[model samples]
Target: MAVVRPVRGDRVRVYDLQVQGTSNFFAGQVLVHNCLIVDDPHKDRADAESEASRRALHDWYSSTALKRLQPDRNAVVGIQTRWHPDDFAGRRLAEEGRLEEGGRWKVVHLPAVADAKFGADPLGRAPGDPLPHPKIPTRDRKALKAWWADMKRTSIVRDWHSLAQGDPQPAEGALVSEELLRLLRDSATKVEPQKIAVAVDPSGGGRDVAGVVGGFLGDDKRVWITHDVSAVMSSADWSTAACRLAYEANAAIIYVEANYGRDMCSLAIRTSWETLQRDGEIPENVLMPAIDLVTAKQGKLLRAEPVAQQMVQDRVRLRGLFVDLEREWSTWMSTDPDSPGRIDASCILTYGLIPEANKGAIVHAPLPQAPVSGGRGPSQVAGAYGRRIGK
Candidate 1:
């Protein structure tokens, strides 16, 4: 073990990278003075063979954490970690090696399910009051214990950067594995889809394969992806296939990524429907499927995170085997998604399933200025007497 560096003016702090971890770990007090910034316990764990080398100047700010004796301004932190591709909190930490704990968060870090330490080195002399160890189960669950044991060695280069030092990548946290998927796949439908939609991603260049996916929002609030119609078809062909899939799946909406050309994509689908009619491919009685045009202001990885989160929440399912589709998901990188069409279509499908009432980033935007009740003030002369109240 390395000699511990002295941290000046320190408090007993429990930080979190997320709101859940923050709320869970923070069980302490903060008083003025005797404050310390940090001590670099472990060097930014460098990758011997790659550009993962760490330096004092580069990590002087982000890589540092505090260490001090008891009864100070620190609490035993709890890190509530759930692996998902849409882990915005994780991504923020990964990018630029730090995010300002934005969202009005007071502190940051995840809760440890087990011991928080390096090899044989416990969490300083100030991990918890009166004891060096955290309050964890005597026998931690086997699966969780395994993750903690191998947290460093098991994760890929991308993930180690984010989870360890807050260095994020597009492909870091979405927790999907071949084993997990295989275990969940079914030979028969277990439930019926309450609502159906066909999500499409049309590429700007003809060389790219257009991604088309069909999903059903089940009564159980689980999104079961049923089909993948992604192919290297011309504009008219892909549109026609998407329309056909909508009819086959009894889908009510054809959600299309309108980023490249909104009108052209929408019109192409409709025109394809008409062409289908001309060829007697689709029944004349069926009206053209409705278009739900979607645009993307965020990057592909950002869009993917929420949907990947659905999988982590067990709110997403795969009705049948989607070998190629799952392959896209497994290899999809966060910084630059590989098979973007497949992932984009997947996002649209899951997003459509997200309840209308529960959508978008939850913000604490200040309320519009409204006159205070009781003539603007009662006890403190209009709350501040038109001047700053505190130093």
Candidate 2:
């Protein structure tokens, strides 16, 4: 053992020491070992929420920290509170499955209150039971309940779920539920649809992926989502994709969100349709689906609420599984900085199919009808297009 004393100086020099057999040393009163320990890698809530920050942390762990570990003797451990879905804890869980599912890491999740939705609580507490605290007496149930109630009352829903519940997303805030979607899934073959539509949410040259989704109003009066081909693409590519989906679905109309570039958005679809016809992608005999420009007069959340309600009421069904689109719908939060493109397209598709869902949030205007050929009007063309595909 050695006696240590502090020395006063203008500038202090630091040195690293290697322990003999134990490979461990004492700093002040705490034991320092040769294992990697990451404690709250994110500086704050803002950093946790930033994608760049999360990437930087993950990069350092993968590129630098892991390399320093001793193959047999060292281990890695991360301790953090849930901040965002892409936070370190979340990224790890996503990359490597959860422990129960055979992940490499062992997770000990303790929420402020027990929520069965997350998983079984280690403390054996039932749902709604407050976590036991050493500072508070064990017998004080009333005090613990009051404390948790106050916390929930003061904190926002997202924060309460992330910080208190150890869950980044709460079902209360999501636009749709994966469970409900799964339950509504239809396994039967496609049936005749009264009307079909393709909806587009343009990227407007931003980082967002353009959203192109197709659905049909079935004889049962339910909106059935049949296609989702959202992707990061150029203007021409997305417009072409939207037009192609419309043609394949025999959609009577194509609805496009004109929030970013109103005239330009409609123009892109029209140009793509015309080009497809010229290139023989669409038959010359089949008239192009009518293009309707939808200008959003309300916030994204406000416009989406009615559609979400429609789903809850069993008015919306999935013809098949759309994994990526469903993920966006289930995990997207109202507080997220960027609006998810898939969800935007879905809202447009739903509102277009079920006009009653609009509720004044959107104003629709049809583009000038393509010159009718052979005495076929827009209505007659639409009727023809509405016929079931492959019938």
Candidate 3:
């Protein structure tokens, strides 16, 4: 039996304990007062023969013993959050209320479980990511208000508790965008692959560990994340895993972010591949090649924004192996706090689509066609009704 009473609040207490049918009838009397409240009333009646159990608890509550404990008329508030309003406790309280005609007991209805819906981090981070402690952004304040309003209106949503709010450990990324999540749910599917490329974001040096991602680019530029192996491992160990994934995917191009370890990533991957090949233990038939280094002049923030636009425009399609990217997308947060998952995956997708020399395509806006010139310049054109120009 666990009793949860508020230490700070005045005249408020909560108790949660499992007791047998015989024990429950007198449990309330243990802490009888002028105002007694009960929660989850229906659960206490599930196994008991409803009518008998109801009468037993009530008879005991209104007994001489309880009357002596609280001589005045005490208000028994049954604040049950059960789904069914006709459960034993609810029904008993209703009966008592009727018999006493406004004094003995009151049945209050309050829904217990609630959903915590998430919205986009306007500051550009993923959902569940923490803001710099105590530095609440204006956008977050707005999002909280919006979430409350939404919950009030719908009354049927609950947070994915195990993942979002279940742990005492703080969440790490910007809230995943609803629009992007909806798009992913609607668009993600499985497909066979023709060409494959693996991108590695190694974090072995710092508090962050390492994330090696492999994506299969099929016909029509549809991309499927084939693998997302993120863990704390030595450079050599991570290299072995990366090679294994590449070989399994039959990937030709291994793209490693060269910023962190530079040439070390490439060397480690090649060394691991050679070791595996010599040992005759390589799992797949694909040739293990040295990783190609991909340089980024811009930061991750700038790199991912364009991809988000592509997703919204339906230019990007995410298929299988989306688990890691999905988690990343669901947790990416900016300094101001926004999710950048779609953007990060988009960078990988875009890099595969457009070459460095062809970055022109990414920034191209069709030049607006120069407004067609309208047959004459301003000096030669006259106003409507034949008025002279500049008159």
Candidate 4:
């Protein structure tokens, strides 16, 4: 706990409220674990060994990598780390499943970036790790090397830990290249949304940025991103902002992650829609669109991989400039839980666009609202957003 001196000289206060003679946590009782991926044959044999080696090896990236390593243990592990070394959270999850005697413990390493669609690598590997130079364009190679050269001296955390090792935090690396982003962008006039959806990843309740992204199945058989209404708003404001994005997109469905407050988010979005209707914003014919609550079963990186591929394959296009959202996509490696709000929104949007993937996941409202008319431009919706939604 005594890590560094505070800047503002504000002392940390601690008060233990445990009743007298009540304690569960032990002191210095290290529980050695022989962990592996769920199905690692080598680890499976190792688990049967009477004196199994305490050492375990795996990279921080995806769980699929560990599946190749056969394992047998009562407890499975999945570590979400920015580095190779064990973090507090990883240890805590392990501790929860720690056995006093008989239960075999297996911890899986999960290396992920906030925006799987963007970043250094799946394992967060740098360019020059195993190669003198990667196959990047000459300009990009030079830029990367130059950035690294400057960053090594300037950066507190260098590539040795990230390049030679695993970790995305501290360095705060970029995921997507300029070419990739430019390639995904299209002329606003050329792209038109046929079936739109708004995706929201709320921050529960805080001054954190709420990701609100809208896009639709394009006429070109691609997913076209329309807008990014993400902002660092209060709970009330963000909820309304989310609905505003949905309204502006004329989205048939508003997909909200229920990991936070399912009821709270649902109510907030509905309230915003009702407000817009009261102000005669959307046409009366446009009934309240279906609100679908989603709960993510897979990791963020896994969920985002398909969407990333679509963008890389030129199957995803941006209708307009969303600078900040692009930055979030370009820079976030899944180190922090909530840094890449925009990217999270992208994952939700992509899932909704894929019919098979979205099957049985969405719950429609009984009363279907009228569809949005393409006659009016997004400007009217934007104005309504500014006055009422933001208000």
Candidate 5:
């Protein structure tokens, strides 16, 4: 037998539009009277696009509404999932102070959504009568169980789409906060001009521009990045540019990656610094330390993870002089694997200064112990005398 479904609603009709749900926005305006509440808490492409979608919905409602849509009153709650609080609702609340810490607009953590009842109860009827809301396709326990199996196969951080907004499953991993990411972006854009450091990732063939990332480490152990400059040139050419940048920024150290260009690149950069000093081009107060080589054996991803985590955790701060750095970071994160060059190089430089987080807990290398020699010395010594004293 076929059942008839109603197109319009009387008053409050509950709809479940699930993951990547957008139809609800238009459907709600057409059928229901309430604003859409997305339970998605993770930062996904959907969340990234939410702000635009929200704007479109608002526009549609304002123009399309027969009566007042009450833009200010329509509240969307993205609960349960751990995502950047900077999402459409979160940022609006932050700026307006309309949402309080424990208020209605809050990021809630629960054992599981199943622990709480979802969807509308049709049995609890009112005088206006009832209508069924369209159900949105959601990732259920079966899909989540599958996602949990998949998570074991790869680094979850690399798969933000899955980890952030994929199947909601419990993983023994801590997710990075959006507030922290905002803080890093804010900090990087505000790096101070006086204290800075430039770490070079050199390209010797003159084909690829040597990357020079400029940032300063503050007394509070926060790093403020100012610039990330990459251009094609000879070692000397880049050295000259680096020196100028360092001088202008009053950078403390010039760290040159000595693996590819080896000692030659380091010497070239030092020589350029000296040339500027001799010509009285650089100020006396601006101290340029000797080139220091970072000798940690780790992949780019491994080395960069801590820095990224720190940025997302508010552990590292970018000061006022880092306009360029902030731009690069936003671009790099949005599109990873393609243009991570400047961002990667900058992260390496940041780690060079703040090594503790990267180094983690130190394990003591075994030391060579002295040989024990307390055997029988003479013919008279026997039995117990034959035993070693410090064996």
Candidate 6:
């Protein structure tokens, strides 16, 4: 094995190798073997960030690369610096269950700098300690710190954490930050809601999960997310789940996204509500929540941006920890291919609860107005308006 500089203007060429003795042999300057070695699987930064590119690499590895390995003899190895959370190495680790516990792969994670959050440093370095390098003398702690500081200063937070710390996070490009979510969670307290609603983003029997999230407008003018029943289910199942959540939360309205299946979404909820009432699942005294079909006139990112800003302004709270929903909020990016159903539903719920977040384009439903003196309250007005819209 050796490193040799290519001659200027050298033409690129490919050659086949046939080792005579050992499994390994020198090909040009580098040692080569029949064993599969995926070095920096992603082509570049853009490729690493792209979902399509990641999937392509994953497919090639699973379908093509694995087949090329010799049965019971040849080994597979992958080496890469962390990029996105869904990058090739990340996906491979997740698929093999190595992300959570011990699995097939023997992972040796060596970040340029140590971080305690990822686990103890393999080199026994404390958090913030730089990885030992010959270029920076071990005795020169000031030089080492200065070098890492320069690296961090030059790179974006996401890239610095991923490429340098080996802890990839959808931080810079993410719609919401985990830190903000945590702050909201810490400040949230149990308060009797003034108005409650359930929002749904139907999957329409597709592979995507149907999102059913419930939230309430607190007296403090903050929207608090209380429930997330999002799942991969049939039309009937999701509708039923949405209705059940609404019933449990005593939600005054059920807001369903109607961009795709306008009538189907509304009809499903109404049908489920009727079925629930007829079967005594819902008591006779409890009136069914008004079903309001909402249509989005803007792109998802545009619709969600206002709500994210509201979160930043401390207008959104979580009644408790919603793990999956929080994960979606913290990691979802505009460039991501698949629509995040949970986020969609949460945005709808937020827009419904905090009318200011709607920004006029994301929702078609009449924004519930504040109560006038000697008139119906906001909930009453909203319920009446919902009923009128339902009709």
lDDT of 6 by residue, 145-200 (tens): 88988988877566677778877776456767766776667322435567789999
Candidate 3 ranges beyond 4 A from true positions: 1-179, 185-194, 283-286, 336-346, 356-391
Candidate that would win on lDDT: 2
Q: Output the worst ten-in-a-row residue range by lDDT, candidate 1.
A: 379-388
TM-scores of all predicted structures: 0.47, 0.57, 0.46, 0.46, 0.42, 0.53
**lDDT scores in order:** 0.53, 0.71, 0.46, 0.51, 0.48, 0.70
Candidate rank order under lDDT:
2, 6, 1, 4, 5, 3
- Among these predictions, the greatest TM-score belongs to 2
Question: For model 1, how does the per-residue alpha-carbon lDDT over 263-341 read when each residue is reduced to its tens digit?
Answer: 9888899898888878898777766657887765356655665565556555677777787677666545544334457
Model 3: how far is 176 from its true place, Å? Answer: 5.9
Error of 3 at 155 (Å): 32
Candidate 1: lDDT of 224? 77
lDDT of 5: 0.48
Q: On residues 1-391, what C-alpha lDDT tens digit does candidate 2 reach at each position? A: 3222222121221122223345333322334334455666666565675556778878966786667555554445677778878888788888987657888666778899888886888789899889877888878988998888888887767778877888876344566765666666774634457788999999635466889999888656778898999998778889999999988878888988866787888888889988998999988777777888776546877777677777776777777787777767766666655567888898888888887887733222211122111322222222433833331
After superposition, candidate 4 runs with Cα above 4 Å error: 1-175, 188-192, 279-285, 355-391
Error of 1 at 180 (Å): 3.4
